[model samples]
Target chain A: MTGGTAARGPLDGLVERVRRDPGAIGALFPAVGRTVGRGPGPSGDPDGILGPTVQDEARAALVSALAAALGDGAPDRLAEEVEALYRFGDAEEKRAVLRSLPVLPDGDAASRLTAGLLADALRGNDPRLIAAALGTPAAAALDDHAWRHGVLKCLFSDVPLDAVHGLGDRADAELGRMAAGYAAEREAAGRSVPDDARRLLSLTHGETEA
Target chain B: MRIFDPHVHMTSRTTDDYRRMYDAGVRALVEPAFWLGQPRTNPGSFHDYFDGLIGWERFRASRFGIRHHCAIALNPKEANDPRCAEVLRTLPRYLAKDGVVAVGEVGFDAMTADEEKAFAHQLSLAAEHGLPVLVHTPHRDKAAGTRRTLELVAASGIPPERVLVDHLNETTVDMVDDSGCTLGFSIYPDTKMEPERMVRILQRRGLDRVVVNSAADWGHSDPLATARTGEAMLRSGFTRDDVDRVLWRNPVEFFARSGRLLLQELAPYSGGAFAGNSILRAQHAEPDA
Candidate 1:
């Protein structure tokens, strides 16, 4: 077990159990939900209508367990389960699935399978989900044009620049040109561009200069 | 609605955040010494961070017309690091400074033995200095951590009223509430508590001894969370006086026990540089005549 999974306590054991018995996915939901709901306060709702942070953490653990449990199947079957989870899950569950894309079984192939979901998330305005999608390991699978659009979408929706993964490393001349164009448009419209845009532009400029 | 954010980290925020917070009626705030996103290798890094909190950050906030005070401590997360144990000895001098308000962000993170020791030691520091404390409850096991925090504070002989157990939610507020310690809620964009949820908490618990803060840091958070909460309260039929008590006066009264909260009236920041040098560039600009 890695250090990160070891820290999650019972969820780690449950993951192993589910790996042996795939039918345990049914039992996994209530267990994870109960864990999420166990912390203090009014506890009548076992489904755990908790804060986003706690929910996100719990959901991420559950998704990891699911992905690991399904790892024995063929790559296509694993992808199907992941897609089903993303499609059938609630907002928090969907976010967890989206975030787990990078760690899912087939690496780049698995990430590519979720292209529709990623594109949809980019088009949507839920910053939390958008950030999760953008920061995921799967985001590296995006083509340059889609990646540039994702960057611009973050700016347009007021999401923090920190949400974008590998921002400094990913900067390129095309991104810089796009940022310059965005800056000029903002100026022409008697508006100011975001500080992050300037930062992105500067990083891209540095890379180009190098 | 002059808000006093009893616990926030301005070190991670930009000057634009300060200006926006000031415009949203944040006249004063306390930047509690907490863990930066990354761990520091030694005690010297902590000293430098503490100095920045009390020195350059204060100066920077003043330029935006906000009063900045700080709470110094060895954060709970760092307490486990043997290298950071030296910080416990150096906290006193910083605690005695003029703008130092309380000892805080100093409770349980992982609830480890070292964290307990650091927490107890800091509580004693608060008692010795006659300062208030801002306790950060562990996010993972908050109810148990909060219970342990109250017990430790009680064992240390620090009065419950002198401590503010922060990062509370619906589950933990009753414990802090019944304990007679001040309650702190950190309103965030997606985590912690939301504006409507906070308003509901206030409605259920009443507004006495409660303080709201943005607790904005190097994460996905909102600097305007306090202001947004105030707006939510008004829209939910809370009186203006109730908003004052929760958002402003509660924090003022809580930290006032330190005898270091100097609530001065600062002039609104007109567009100009700090000592004739703007953040944009280093060259001094002539005063407009």
Candidate 2:
């Protein structure tokens, strides 16, 4: 559906339903796991399955299409749809909402309204939520300190840093310092520092290309 | 040293913790449905939480090569909330699901009339479903709460052997022991019960009809407390077989009463990209569906 996978029949069917009645997102969002699929691949990606599995992409695409359909006239409706799906939805549903945040109408207002949701996900131990929270443009709502802590969370939880959006641009000296401290703690505890943390340190030192 | 942590909240834990738990020899666990540290205003949230306990959390544990199981109930603290009472109606549906080893953590939090009412109701649900009950005694008023818990367990007409009275200490353990129900002790990092105290209790109590858990949740607790208690038993001159009896066999025998414990090895999560970030990678461009 996104860029050439098999069977767009179900995805196209969902898109038609949402376009006909945007309100259908509430029901359609949760059913994405069943309609789209978890994708076919080996799960052993070291980056951790804090995913937008290929199927998740299909679901997000459907959400984006709905947002574009609602357009400027119904930002509130879009917001309401996102909120309901996130609040009542499971981890997969929540991830889908987080994935579609950037594509929702009115980016600035959407970002502000969902900042608390982003913060809530960041505060949790679930690597899936943490990665989804930071992986989207919605994460821009997070301030410098919380953003740095999110990176630290990825390090602590072994979520690959590449999952974090805007890491190249946002990887500041403070984040580098935090990573160094975390590395020191891991070393002191006789634990190996994650390669991602070490890579983050190199970026801050301007010794390595992002 | 393969461990079956009878009670834990893996929903609040991380994959790293799962990996560590696996490394420490924990191959299976029963994550009881409990309060989320924040009160829910709607019964729907509990449904989602329960779904995660059975669906996603189960899969997550499988990814770590550990078999995960759960206990379904309206926990004691939340039973007082009339808003949460609606969830009790749905408890039967989940209790009938696979991997639901018991109806649990259901005894008392404040020993309130509301807590007692919900506790008694869930005990009946466990009885109806032929599932075991996991009773959590109040952290405060430990002795009185446990006594009332046993009295209600007796009143429910469910066999005492079908119940697990959790979170007992020196003061409460003897009574739960005498009640003929399985005794559950949660070994914490600092407070409640520590490794040495747990060892002393095992020494005095001898390990029959006993189970030890990390009871680790969103609090300062160890996921490896069961393994630590096993190590403590070894240092105290208990044989490995004795440690195995208490740490592994005892809890297995208790929860397996549900005939639902999945002990077979599952391949760790090897599939890439979960229900997670791949779509967010696209630059704000709405894909044409």
Candidate 3:
């Protein structure tokens, strides 16, 4: 596919493939192994470049295709598929499914259904998974309280502030207050506050400190 | 064993990294202009960054006896920001500077329309300025991004031989090789290709027009990765001549096209102070008179 077309239509061809033979989704697993484990030799892996590993790229492509194909279907049905993928998949696979949450049709319903997964991811120590959950378009669907907690979670976990999308737009008095409280607690314990936390707090007050 | 780490972000690195790199036989290096982790607000920020790359950063590297060169361009990730578009107008002046060698770290990130426009414009700038181009392929969607990069280079009318496409892995190597552009592999830690894997690639592909770099940036990366790769090559039964070809000769050949590459050994710093003043504020205290 041309670069122009690929950016414009990320799931265009993949949706048809998933719809035509949903059973073929299982094939992505082995393809992931073939592409990820060893070199593709001189021919090169056609499925490569979604990420560092073939597994990551394949999983991301498959999840995105499945989400798009099943967008208009019954909400519960789509949730079940996502749940199965999350449960049966590895850490990278789970990350792919979480990242696909935003691109799925019916953004509101998808965000609602995946809130638990996002919450679970935020509670984890894996920076990439947390980054995936926060960076997604679905992350925009987070309610004020959830979003505030997500920001705090990132600070407490040492994830970079850049991982949080629309940070400047979303900064508010409440987040600022929370960040100050976090900073004070770190100070009381004789620890330095994260640089991003300071940046986040500055953003709440509309100051360009960084 | 003298090496030229053709692509690295020494701005994000520490002076100790410079010391280690110098000790590892890295006599010269190039720090490409790249995203500074945070989104810069305007074109003025880019001008300041370019100035540092040419001025302060060069002096700092000279302290460690490493000749510092830099490539000036709007990085691909930031090209999409309209606020920074004015940088294109500001690039020609910096591109002509002494330590500047190429118009680089330029290519697709998200493959946005704005990115393509900036990339094409910079390629033209490289041709007009009589310099080589350093292209960074997207970390995500790398294959299609690389194909598009080559297509754009072909369209830009800059000969493929004058471009060095960096951050390539095993999957994208063949495409870059077939295109006749110089191949650049960033042997970074976890995210990019590893040293052992890089050795295997060199073993298979042979070190013709290939350059290996560390690309050590602000993130969790090792500045000594190029030296580590050289060590790996030797461990794998490759000759020191093979290591030298990939690490030094290939990069020298690529950047020499610009007529700006200075391969001469620079004199090491004679005085302990930088610019006639030491960072230490006071002399050692005399004990009780």
User: Best by lDDT, which number?
Assistant: 2
- lDDT scores of the candidates, listed in order: 0.76, 0.79, 0.75
Measured with C-alpha atoms, the lDDT of residue A38 in candidate 1 is: 39
Give me the runs in candidate 1 sitting further than 4 Å from their true place.
Answer: A1-210, B270-289
Better of 2 and 3 by DockQ: 3
Classified by CAPRI criteria, candidate 1 counts as incorrect
Per-residue alpha-carbon lDDT of candidate 1 for residues B52-147, written as tens digits (9 for 90 to 100): 899888878887889999999999878867767788999999999989999988998656678899999999899999999999986544566789
Instruction: Report the C-alpha lDDT of model 3 over A33-89, residue by residue, as the tens digit.
Output: 443332221214222211223344445566666665665766666676776676566
* Candidate 3 residue lDDT tens string, B1-289: 7889999999998877888888899999999999876456589999989988997788888877888999999988678667687889989999888989999989986566778999999999999999999999975446677999999998988888899999988768999999999999998765577888888888898889999999999878988999999999999999999899989989989988888877678765433554444322254222321
TM-score-better candidate, 2 vs 3: 3
How well is each residue in B1-289 modelled by candidate 2, as lDDT tens digits?
Answer: 8888999999989888899999988989999999886556569999999999988888788878899999999988778667678899988899999999999879876456778899988988988999999989865345667889999999999999999999877777888999999999898764357778888888887888999999999977889888998999899899989988988899999988999888987776444333552222353333441
Q: DockQ of all candidates, in order?
A: 0.02, 0.02, 0.02
In CAPRI terms, where does candidate 3 land? incorrect
Backbone clashes (count) for model 3 = 0
Clashes of 2: 11
Go through the candidates in order and give the C-alpha RMSD of each one to the true structure.
20.8, 15.5, 21.4
Model 2 spans > 4 angstroms off:
A1-210, B272-289
Q: After superposition, how far is residue B130 of candidate 3 from its true place, in Å?
A: 0.7
